[model samples]
Target: MSTHVDDADRLARVTLSRTIEPGDLRVTGLVSELGAGKVLGYLEAAGEVENHWGFALAQELGRVDPAQVLVQAAEQGIRFIVPGDPEWPTQLGALSNTGALHDRGGEPVGLWVRGAHDLHQFAGNAVAVVGSRAATSYGTEQASELSRDLATMGHTVISGLAYGVDQAAHRGALLAGGPTIAVLPGGVDRPYPAAHAQLLDAIAERGLVVSEAPPGVGPTRTRFLARNRIVAGLAEGTVVVEGAVRSGAINTAHWTTNLHRPLMGVPGPVSSAASAGVNQLIRLGQASMVTTAQDVITDVMTHAARAATGAEQLDESFVPDPVRYPQSAGPGPAAGISASRR
Candidate 1:
């Protein structure tokens, strides 16, 4: 989709947003199934000839004040880009054919995107780095260094913005002077965990924080699972830094794999409990091992560059030794890596 659209399409998208329920699969399916121009038609066919369904659905969802929600969405400078809209990401559209598309748990009829940068900029070239919330210092350092390296190479880093690996990725990308996107499990206005409020604010200001849920929706167990699909969908590949045996990060890895995106894992020592899952992924052939950002990016970016430019093959490289951080590195308050593990 192009980054420009007609005023009518934008208004229709806003109207659709007001109508859909938070995390309602039926509503999201209807939007995806019918696309933009036909959404009103489908709603009318369901009942009501005078566009009553749009306003009525808003009231039924108890969105504080139906009219107020629309007003607030507009006041915040948020714009909704539906599937057929020019700004709708082409990469996201590809998901529809794969049956692995997340579509933000069928809540968002259109993304309520804000910030100076266009949302499609993320689709330009993105990769997600996710791992356990209880990450070790080694996992955190790998995530941070990988994020920074990717950002420095003009790639947008994507993550969940949780503690541990997620936080490290965001800080690393920010430190590298690059934009990043945090796809939240709740509303854009609602940052989960509450403790990350300052960090989230910084991301929304300098980068982008996105969600499929409506403005007032809070995070939930189900919402967290749904958000992972989005992280996988938005990026060309996903890298699992460190996770526990049954971690949510594994869900994102599976989603990426199912969607035919490359799945990479940052391998850690077998002795580290935090890296056991990552090692398992490598062992099972579900993901390739990546010790550095270039290892992962080579598969996603360099091959494409080579294809486009007809360049000769290049030798593989590792991250600089001086910058390589270990899991045993003593943690300080600023680092955010778990101190207990240190």
Candidate 2:
């Protein structure tokens, strides 16, 4: 917790490296104690760590040397955000059972963040809007509009930097001149899909691009799953724009539900495959419907007011179809919308 320790960062990195491959009990025991940089320092300090559990773990699993990773990150001018640090996101720490990791056991111990933006301002009152990679034009527009409205209303917007809905959310917030944050599945330096490099750069310059992974790491299926949790954890609520039943956005919705955060979904035409997951959430009572920024703001405010007042039942009347699109008010897209619209 002390940020000024001389050798602590190096030890943290060593701990990270030693927890891999054969996995040293000594390093593993220190996992919860040391931060990422300190762990790596411990590994290097020992000098005998090459291929001894730590090296193999980094090599096989593609985990970078915590110290080396930090150096690379610093080269990119990225800051390492550790738990209990000034810049560490407090909302994420709410998942104590998950060790303050993002999402429901998906996020890592700390994040490597690159940007001049203040994540705290966004984290305290943020909403995540996520959906399918293959988004329809209508879905994209709705996502953008939702993001714009959220930003205009002073809510921080959070999302993955993936194609379709993810990209739209970031763009919308930027276009609206609102603060937004992109949670990457890989290291902040590794922009997945490679196509959104410019978008990622814009985010880092104007907002923030964050990742829990050490630097130099690339995207993997597991990392993608992990990224979703950070998206959910950073926000007070989440809105599913468009996605299939088994889509990653659905995973985020589930995480939101588990976190007791309000989950909202923008309904698409029933015939649209992208809306299937959201519609299903609505049907299952997992998420409420949200069509406009007003709906989201009202719900969030109501929840906050109730919590402050120690009320058991928060008011849900501000939204029309509380279960379907609670306060949603938008034209439904045509059925069979393509994912590319996003």
Candidate 3:
């Protein structure tokens, strides 16, 4: 299944992944224009005369030997999937349009994957469930129940594998014997929280644990933020169970909105601070209020079916325009929900 050209491309992407930070525009642009092998060749050469940033990146590239990294990854059962790979999730292409997430918005050069399940299959019919790590019991229960219900309906549950809501969601999906993908901020081989080492291992055994970083790299705040885009991009929709008004979950919601994907939020007790972000999105009409998993499945499938058939003539009352909920929009509860046709 491997060709010489495919091997070279995969190695080049692994090198690039090690050389630059995730979502770095400079490297993305260079790889887009010259291809990864050429970019590596350019880095090997010492003739870079302009762009201080490019020069610095080239200097860093010289330190990494791509072949060795590949060996290390293979020893650990990791595989690098490039754009041409069949396992590469095509939905990630939507990230190219999310300029607000990255300065040089483009598809990832490659992904460092560690799992037996195909990435494309895991992403298909997926719904990302994200929220604050500091979640309350109510939030945790809701996330778990919703994920269980979604998984029972054959939708792959996707999350960042963080604490609280994410943990609950992943566990719920696993309990239902459904595939669950954990998009990591750090390397798939290095679980960030450390406590989740067993959890991550279980996920890789049954589903997937993928990242942009190489094997030895650990997570930083910046990596965590950047990885949110991948989580949002891989899913057909994103659900925020509970979070503050300014949390990473909200950031993921923004990415989902930017990609024109269905965004859903589970309402929690108004008295709980953890529910602030979800309530805010609902009040501003940025997300559809989804109380149950059936609500999520219906909304996601309805949107997908409509898009597939070019049936853009849905009743205006059923489709809420996200544009109406600008960042500066004031607080007001969303209007009545449209009845699900199914």
Each model's lDDT: 0.70, 0.71, 0.81
Model 2, global lDDT:
0.71
Candidate 1 similarity to native, TM-score? 0.76
Writing each residue's lDDT as its tens digit, candidate 1 over 1-342 gives: 354556555565555555554445555566567664466555545554445545556344333343556578768755555665555566665445444333344434566565557667666678899998999898888889889877876678999989999999999999989899988887777877689988888888888887766666788877787788778878878999998768889988877887777899988888988888889999999998776666666566543444445656532332222222222112111222222212
lDDT of 3 by residue, 155-191 (tens): 7899999999999999999998989999998899998
The worst-scoring run of ten residues by lDDT in candidate 1 lies at 324-333
Question: Looking at model 2, how many pairs of residues clash?
Answer: 32
Which residue pairs show collisions in model 3? Answer: none
**Segments of candidate 2 deviating more than 4 angstroms:** 1-68, 98-107, 314-342
- lDDT score for residue 214 of model 3: 77
RMSD of each: 8.0, 7.4, 6.9
Question: Looking at candidate 3, what is the lDDT of residue 51?
Answer: 54
lDDT of 3 at 123: 92
Error of 1 at 10 (Å): 4.7
Q: Is candidate 1 or candidate 3 better by TM-score?
A: 3
Q: How well does model 3 score by local distance difference test?
A: 0.81
TM-score of 2: 0.77
Ranking by lDDT: 3, 2, 1
